[model samples]
Target: EEVYASQPDGFVDPDNPNHVYKLKKALYRLKQALRVWYDMLSSFLLSQDFSKGLQISQNPRGIFINQLKYALESLKKYGFESCDPVDTPMVEKSKLDEDKEGKTIDPSHYHGMIGTLLYLTASRP
Candidate 1:
């Protein structure tokens, strides 16, 4: 029921030039397509008694936020399984400066570790 008319026969095959295809779906070019699709999906969910979940932001509607699963997976992936859990990510007196005298590990691997820790801060902080 949300179908719209598109430009007529612009690229139709010459043998089938007489045929006019009716569009039954939304297209990216249409300004209202996203809104219409969202409204339609929301309406269907509501009709089935599924209430909208809490919105975490206003710029985009209907977004849900949760971090438990991500944190658990990160802990597993980083081999923290047997290690003792620390109350704080960083120690009170610990310094995190680049160790100029320490044996250098692969820059890519170090950067990857730093990236994961940085992302964890979003939830842990």
Candidate 2:
């Protein structure tokens, strides 16, 4: 991954005043570097028998990695605890319809909902 930085004061070459420096080494703040760090840490955690309880994907083979309390807490934290329950997760009849005339939702709120759902999947084994 490419990383860029501008030369600090007194370090800039006077002949190339408009030039910016390209980073050759992976910095701790870079996104790719952070991902590598996270992978290493997660690998270490898994090696120690710690599961990623908040992960979204489910594993088969009848493993009982329940996160019921975590799911409940997440729902409450996202203000869904008192909301009316749905018999089914989605309505098949509305699958093809686009909400062209419906009120617009905040993008941040929509992302928050997705995040909560992903976390809620931890309870599913």
Candidate 3:
């Protein structure tokens, strides 16, 4: 079905007030646009040679997507439950500097943390 909508109240063009915007991209909650969107996304996933099971759900509010469970599991696996929550990914900004006088961090510990971050970014990005 063809869909056209007038510009929003404040966004309407002064010179062409009668013109309406024609939708090219699927907009969720706009008729069957959600179905069209899923078709495009699933086809792209298939083209990447990936299997099924993309987690997504619909509710009264809207679509929901998150990796909080996976993130929590990863933190627990890496023994980060005791670590202070930092704004940065690996560590706080001040602690990032190299300390010549301090004991060097274990290479294996660094490797595991970095590897975990890489794997998470690969899937989540």
Q: Using TM-score as the measure, which candidate wins? A: 3
lDDT of each: 0.67, 0.75, 0.77
Q: How accurate is candidate 3 locally (lDDT)?
A: 0.77
lDDT of 3 at 103: 90
Q: Rank the candidates by lDDT, best first.
A: 3, 2, 1
**How would you encode candidate 3's per-residue C-alpha lDDT over 60-99 as one tens digit per residue?**
9999766666667668877887788667566445556577
**Model 1 residue 47 lDDT score:** 100
Worst 10 residues of 2 by lDDT: 55-64
* Segments of candidate 3 deviating more than 4 angstroms: 1-55, 87-101
Q: Whose lDDT is greatest here?
A: 3
lDDT (C-alpha) at residue 120 in model 2: 65
Error of 3 at 91 (Å): 12
Count of steric clashes across candidates, in order: 0, 0, 0
By TM-score, is 1 or 2 better? 1
Please give the ranking of all candidate structures by TM-score, highest first, separated by commas.
3, 1, 2
Candidate 3 matches the true fold with a TM-score of 0.38
4-120 in candidate 1: lDDT tens per residue?
453464576677666555776767868767887899999999899665533344345555565555665656766775777669876689767987889967888777777877876
lDDT of 2: 0.75
TM-score of each predicted structure versus truth: 0.38, 0.36, 0.38
